[model samples]
Structures are given as C-alpha cells and as structure tokens.
Target: MAKASYLAGVALALAAGSALAADLPSRKAPPPAFVPPPPAFSWTGLYGGVNIGYGFGASSSIRGGELLTQVPGAGPFAGAVDVAAGAWNMPTNLNGVLGGGQIGYNYQFSPWLVVGVEADIQAADLRTSQAAGVSYISPVTGAGVTGYANANQYVDWFGTVRGRLGLTLPSWPNLMIFGTGGFAYGSVESAHRYTRFDGSAPLFATQASATTTSTNTGWTAGGGVEWTPMAFPAWSLKVEYLYTDLGSINQVGTGFYSAGAFGGPATMLVTGNQANFRWHTVRAGVNWHFNPFGSSAPVLAKY
Candidate 1:
C-alpha cells in the first residue's frame, strides 16, 4: 500500500507540471517592429535670391585711329584720311561692385547629384577711362598745336542664363559644390572724344565727342559652393566666382582744326577707339527655396 501511494503522488505531480507548461508563452522570436527608413537629402525645389559682389575687369588694350574728313576748300581733303593714331594700342582696366536677383529650379536625380537652370539680372558700376595728349609744331604754318584723345568703357547692367551641375558627398548631404556656364548679355557703353587747339594769333579750338551703347552677348563659366543649414532648411547660402565676356565696343568721333583769322580755314578729323569688356566676379548670396527636403519628398533614403 505505501509503494502504491508514492507512485500515485509522482503521477499527480507530473500532470501539474504539464498543465503549467501549457499555460506558458511561446519561446519563438517576436516579429521585428516596423522601423521605417531614414528620409533622403533632397535639393529639389524652386528658388529666388539676391546677391552682391565685386568685379575685376580684364580689358586688354584700346586700339585708336584718326582720319582727316573735311577742309576749307572742299578739295582732296574732303575725303582725305590720315589714320595716324592707328598705331596706338593703349592699355586700360575697369572694375566695380554689382548687386542683383536670381531665379532658378533644381532637380535631384540621386542623393549625390543635382541638375538645374538659373537666370539672373544685375545692376553694375563697372567702368574705366583713359586719355592721351600730344603737342607738336605744324609742318605747314610753323605754329604750335595741341591734340587730345580720350576713351572709356562702361557696363551699366548685365545678366546671365545658365545651366548648373552639382555634386553632394554622402557624408555632407547639405553641402554642394557646383560648376555652371551659359549665355551672358549686358548693356555696354563706350565714349570717344578728340580736341585740337592752338595758342597763336588765330587762337581757335575744335572738339567733338561720341558715345556708343549696345546690348552685347557672349559666354560665361564658373564654379561655386552652396550650403543649407540644418536650422534653416528652407534657405541656402553660396559663394561663387565667375568669368564673363560681353563682346566689345567700337566708336567714332569727329573734330576740326580752325584757322578762323589766319587767312585760311583748315581740316576736319575723325577719331575713335575699340575696347572689349571682360571681367571676373566674386559673389555671395542667400536663397529662399520653395520646398526642399520636405515630408512629401519621393526618396526614402537608405544610408
């Protein structure tokens, strides 16, 4: 009877353990929680901004020439040409500050690449002037005569339409380095003047001035760095350098040497200069983006 009770007790104990085991939770691994991927660094947006900068002119040399156009007697001198000043090539420089606004659009194809187009207009104050004078004894009347020639180039305003290619590093998604080039256009003006005078008894002077203004077109190329601050995701700042060429200016001026009381009236002269406008500019600017790196962006970045 004692042996029978011990076996029965062991049986009951095993049954209890089995019931407890059935109530316990399963040991299989739980399904992973849904943790979505990080968002992409997108530069896709439309932007507008203002910029200020300084420009250094690379205008090489001014070529000048003069011709004798009119005389008192209407003889061979009516169309006689001298071109004595043709041998002159005067060196000059032009420089100034500029400020303007720009508008552009950017599309991000990948996390590391962006392409865009931009257009800008600027008001500028780039200008320079040069003058030369000479004194000589008149071969005809043995009198002293003074002659002067002055020329200048001024860029009143300018603009550019460009295409840009930009690169972003994976480690620095908010920073981009880019290169740009395109068509450039501007309003340029040139001034040419001439004067002739004598201090003798037939004291007289003749003067003339001419200006040529035109809208010129050329090509421009440059590179720059742009950054978007984490605190100001809707704005970007940039520092850029560009080289621009806006064609050239050619002008013509006229003047006359008068011998009013010297018993003879004298000759007429034409004078002019040709100069080019090219410059390098360094600019800094801030832009306001319409919607960049927003919640609705298409990229679900996996970095």
Candidate 2:
C-alpha cells in the first residue's frame, strides 16, 4: 500500500508540472509585423508661374551705305566721297525692369532626370538714344560742311518657347539645375535721323523709322536653379538667366531736301539701316504645380 501511494503521488506531481508548463506564456517573440515601403518624391506635373527681372546689353547698328543712297544727289557723288560718311553704329546698353508669366509641363524620366517644355511672355521697358556729328569739306564747292545724326531704339516686349533638361541633386531631390534653349520672338522700335549743315547754315534733314511689333523670330538659350520646399511640394522657386537674339531689322527713312548757296535743293533718302535686338536677362519667380500623384506628402520607407 505505501509503495502504491508513493507512486500515485509522483504521478500527480508530474501531471501538475506538465499543466503549469502548458499555461506559461511563450518565450520567443512574435514574428515582426509586416512593414510597407515609403513612397518617393516625383517632379512630374503641370505648372504655371509669374516672374520679375532685369535685362541688359541691348545693342544695335545703322548701315552707313544705305544712308548715302537716300540722298538725292548721292548717286552722282557716290564715287567721289566716302559713302559710309552718314552711316553710324551704336551700342545701346539697355537696362530695365521686366515682368511676366509662364506655363509648362514636366516629366520626371528617372529619380534624377527631368524634361519639360515651357512658354513665357514678358513686358519690358528698355530704351536708349544717342546723337553724333561729323565735319567735312564739300567736294563740289570746296565749302566747309557738317553732318549730325540721331538714333533711338527700344524693345517693348518679348516671348519664348523652350525645352528644358534638368537633374535633381543626389543629396537633395528637391533641388534641380536646368538648361533651356529654343525659339524667341519680340517687338522692337527703331528711329534714325540725319541733318546736314553748310558753312554753319542748315541744309537738309532725313529720317527713318521701323517696327517689329508683328513678329520677330530668333534664338534663345539659358539656365537656372529651382527649389521645392518639403512642406509645400507643389510650390517652387527659381532663379534664371537668358540670352536672346531677335535677328536684325532693316529700315529706310523719308527723304527731305533744302537749297544750298551753289546748287538747287538736294533731295536725300536714308536706307540700309539695321537694328539688332540682343539682350541678357536675369529673373526670379515662383511656381504652382499641379501634381497628379497626390499632395506634396512625404514618402514613407520600410526598414
């Protein structure tokens, strides 16, 4: 009976120990929770913006040979005197304020590369004028003579259509540097006038004027840096520089005549005058982007 009780007690103790082990919590940690990856930033979108800036280096010239042709008696003396006498060239260092707006779309080809097309128009106040005089003796009468010329040129407005290539910084994807090139067009006004004097008395005067207000086509190139803030991904700020050339302008002025002491009234015409609109501009602006992906939300990443 004692051996049976001892064996029974040992079996009961073993059963209780087994039950306790079963009730205790697991020691191994639960499998780690599944994590979702974070979304990446993208520059793909349609954008529009406004800009303000300054322009400089608007240089131009007037053909001298053309001016001589406009003179009534210029053909006969063409070989006797310098045909280039009435011709003048001037560099108008035009510097002024400009403001405008732009619209475009961008496609992010890769994490670091982006391409886009943009168009912009601006109103400008760039103008300048100069006057010059020369003295000479008339080949026909051997009389002392003097000539004076005045010129004025201005660019009223300009526009451009361009393609852009950009690269985002490896360290900061929000920052981008870009280059652009394409077609340029603008409106320009030019005026030229010349006056002749014989022995201190007024002889004759001629004037010419032209306008490219319809369409002036040329080429343009530029580069810039842009930044988008983390808090406002849809908004961006940029600083840019551009060089534009609007080809050349040809104009002819009306002729006028006045009588001299020795000869009948001489008629004069001014021709072969050209004005070139080449300028450099620096600007800053803000843009609003219409992103299709979503709000400027930050991307989340999985560890």
Candidate 3:
C-alpha cells in the first residue's frame, strides 16, 4: 500500500508537469507566409505628345451683316436710292491640315483606372471664295447699270480643355484605352466686295472689302488607345488617335464700300448677312509617360 501511494504521487506530479508544458508559449508562429503586395499600377504624373492628322472642314455661311447694293445707272438717284441687303448667304467648305502638341496630368484611382485633364491647340488653313453682281436703277434718270465684285476668306485654328477617363489593360504590356470630352472655343475670318456703275457711264469704279471674325463655344468628345512601345527605366512612348466636333458658329457681314486693295478698309455699311458653320477634327500623336507610382518601370511593347 505504501509503494502504491508512492507511484500514484509520482504519476500525479508527472501529469501536472505535462499540463504546464502544454500551456507554455507555442513556437513563435512561423512568420506569416511571406506575401508580396499586389503590383502597383502606373498612372500618376505628367505627359506630353505631338499629333498630326488630316483635317476636313465644312463650308461656313455668312450671317448678321448688311450687304450694300449701289445702282450706277441711277446717277444722282444712285446715291439716294441705292438699295442695301444683309448677307444673303455666306460661303462654306474650308479644308486644311491640323498639327499641334498636347500636355496633361493624371491621377490613378486603382490599378486599372485613371482620370486626367488635358489641353491641345491646332492651326488650320481652310478657306472659301465667292462673287456676285447687282444692277442699280435711277428714279430721275431712268437709267441702270451693273456693279460686280468677289470675296475670299478662311476658318482655321482651335484650342480646347477636356477631361479624360482611362482603363489600363494588364494583359497588354503598358497599354491603356481612354475616352475624353470637353469644351472648345475658336473663330473664322472672311471677306467680300462689290462695285457700282453710273447710268450709261462708268461712274468712279467703286470697290469694297470687309472681313468678319466669328467666335463660338462648343463640345468635343473622342476616344483612343495609347501604347508604351519603348518603356525603360520609368519612361515610355505612346501613340494615340482622337476625334472631336466643335459645333457651329454664326457669321456676319458688316458692310460694303470702295476699297483700293485686298486688305484695305472699304466703305462702311451698318448691317450685314448672317450664316453658320460646323467643324470636325481627327489626330494621331506620340506621348511620353513616367510611372512614379509603380515599383517597376514600364516595358515598351507595341500592339
């Protein structure tokens, strides 16, 4: 019985020690499995690009100005009875080339999405020309004669401010597609002239010239793909295309009179004819982008 009690005590002590050992601090949990964070997207920063595209423009009509008609045949009556007409109609169909540069900044909200603001300007050489004639009748002399003249002008140049939304394609190396829209303002300039005849005689051959500039504000929208074909050490090259529509403008002819030269001032009329114009543009360009937000530099790959 004494020997049995001794064995029991020893067993009890061993069991208690086993319990304490089980409660002791566990092996430092193996360091959490090494896990690298997801790759960071590259979108933040500054960029610049040069664009070239064929530009086609519609004809701009004249509006809001007075067109004057003088009767050479009226003689003294010509000065008093001369009739005046506002721009009956303006000419349209100006075509030209568009070339320019663009600059912008961007912020990325996620690995695949970004937003930005951009501005670009382009110069064009689109123009049109027209001619017309009028006959004047004298109330007193009962005589009439014809006066003739022609005019030419152009509509070219534009600038805009816009917002851009884009998505990065992970499958494609350093490639993104974006859409943009914004407001733009621009103007077109044009000129015209006319001549007068005195009854049976060539009264002083009178000529007139005038130029009107029309400004308008309108909306622009377009989308394109950008590629970083040569990316190395945080730098990449991009090529993109975009389309825009800069709505319409109203044109007015101010007056008519005798002018000696093409650009010289002519006789002034208080009123003129009115017309409207609409325009569209397309462009292709190259850009340089740096990804300061990403751990790795861009890889230049073309699609």
Candidate 4:
C-alpha cells in the first residue's frame, strides 16, 4: 500500500510539471528581415519641361542717316543743299509675355555639385514703336522745311543652347542654385517711315521695312533656383532669369521723292541703318525627370 501511495505522488508531480510548462509563454520566430525604401530624390537624370513668363528690358536704337535736296534756281544757280544729317535718335523699350519648352540632362558629381546641358525655345510678343520730327529752313530755297519719322521694332521668337553649373546645400540636397551661359539665336523685324514738307506742300516721303527670318546668333547668361520634393522624386520646380544679346541688324529700303525746285519726280536709295537687340526674361517652370540609369534603393530610419 505504501509503494502504491509513492507511485501516485510521483504521477501528481509529473502532471504539475507538465502544467507549468504549458502555462509559460512560448518563443516566436524573429520578424521577417526589415527592408529599407528607395532614395527620396536624385538629380542624375533626363528632364523635359514647359515654362511661361514675362519679358522686359528689350531695347533698340536707330544709328545713322541723312536727307538732302536739290533746288534748280534757288541755290546760287542750282546745286544740292544739305538739309537733314546724322541719325534720328529713337530709343525703344519692348515688354511682353513669353512661353516655351526645354529639354536637358543633368549629372550629379557630388552631394553639392552638378553639371548639365539644356536647350530651349520661346515664342514672344515683344514690339515697340516711336515717332519723331524735326523742322528747319531749307538751305537752298530758304523755304520752311518740316520732317517726321516713325519707327517700329519687334522680336518674334528666340532660342538658347546652354551649359549649367550648380551647387546644393548639404542640409537640403533637393534644392539647388545654378548659373547658366551659352549660345543664343533669334528672328527680328523692323520698319520706318519719313515724310518731309516745304511751306505746307508735300516735298518727299520714304518708307522702309525689313523682316529677318534668318537666325541671328549671339550669347546668353543667367541664374536660377530649383527644388525637388521627397513626395515626388521624379519632378522639380524652378524659377530663372536670363539676358540675351542678338547683336546688330541692318535694314535697307527705297525712298520716293517729289522734285522740289528741280523737276518732276525721283527715286532714291536709303541705306546705313542698324538696330541693336538685347532682351531680359524671367520665367517659372516644372520639370519631369526620367531615370536612364538603374534605380538605387535607400535606407530607412525610424523617427
């Protein structure tokens, strides 16, 4: 009977041990290996964009010209007399709106340094006009002489191919500031008219107009700031300003004159007129970038 009691005690001990083991918390397999996300932004890519902006500070001037007349019996028995000389000083200011598109490629060499090339074309409405007149006594006829002139200048379109250099803040790698310079080309148009009268009677008048569709090549320089957001890694926004000079433009036109003290009528050639073109522009744009190279994943840090 005592042996039986001892075996019962041993059985109870084994049951208690099994229950204790069951009550203890179980071990769980470690969580699946954590994976990091991709980088928030990168400057190395190809981009295309459209821009709209305002243009001001376009300027032009008339260089040189002259007007002369011959009076048959007025100038000590007939000789040509000098009436108008030098240039009609006309300064024009052009201001308007412009819109365009651009394509470019960028390479980020370091955390703060980037280099790139870009090309853009803009259609503009930049036109200006001025009217001026002068009065004097005719040298040969001693008659009252009055002269009036009207001038207009405009630019239809312009383009640029440029190189870019930029720097970024280490604390904010997504924001960049840059300077750009390169080749520029454009089309320009101009027109002018001059009329003269002697003693309330029309003496002579001339009209000259020219359209230069051929590309005028020059230089351009500017600077800008660009920003990219972590939420939209493939896109950026920018604001920029640029100055372009297209050099000088030459224009020629025919002049029709009515004979004064001389005779019936005459046609004269007018030359040696020039207009210089310089423009300034400020623009804002958004760009969409594409990854030509393979993607690189980024690390994650819990806040």
Please tell me which predicted candidate would have the highest lDDT against the true structure.
Answer: 1
lDDT of 4 by residue, 88-158 (tens): 67777767899999999998877789899999999999777787775777565577766666767777899
**Would you list the C-alpha lDDT of every candidate in the order shown?**
0.79, 0.73, 0.59, 0.74
What's the residue-level lDDT of 106 in candidate 3?
78
Each prediction's total of clashing residue pairs, residues at least 3 apart in sequence or on different chains, is 0, 9, 31, 0
Q: Give the per-residue lDDT digits (tens) of candidate 2, residues 59-114.
A: 55554432322234443333233233444665566668888999999888877898
Residue-by-residue lDDT tens digits, candidate 3, 165-201: 9898666636778898888766666566555544443
TM-score: model 4 vs. ground truth: 0.80
RMSD of 2: 5.0
- Tell how far residue 123 is off in model 3, in angstroms: 4.1
- Name the best candidate (by TM-score): 4
Please give each candidate's TM-score.
0.78, 0.78, 0.59, 0.80
**Candidate scoring better on lDDT of 3 and 4:** 4
How far in Å is the alpha carbon of 54 misplaced in model 4? Answer: 1.4
Candidate 2 regions off by >4 Å? 1-38, 63-86, 200-214, 292-303
Tens digits of per-residue lDDT for model 1, 124-217: 9998888877566544445675667777888999999999999998889899999999999999988877776665665777776788899999
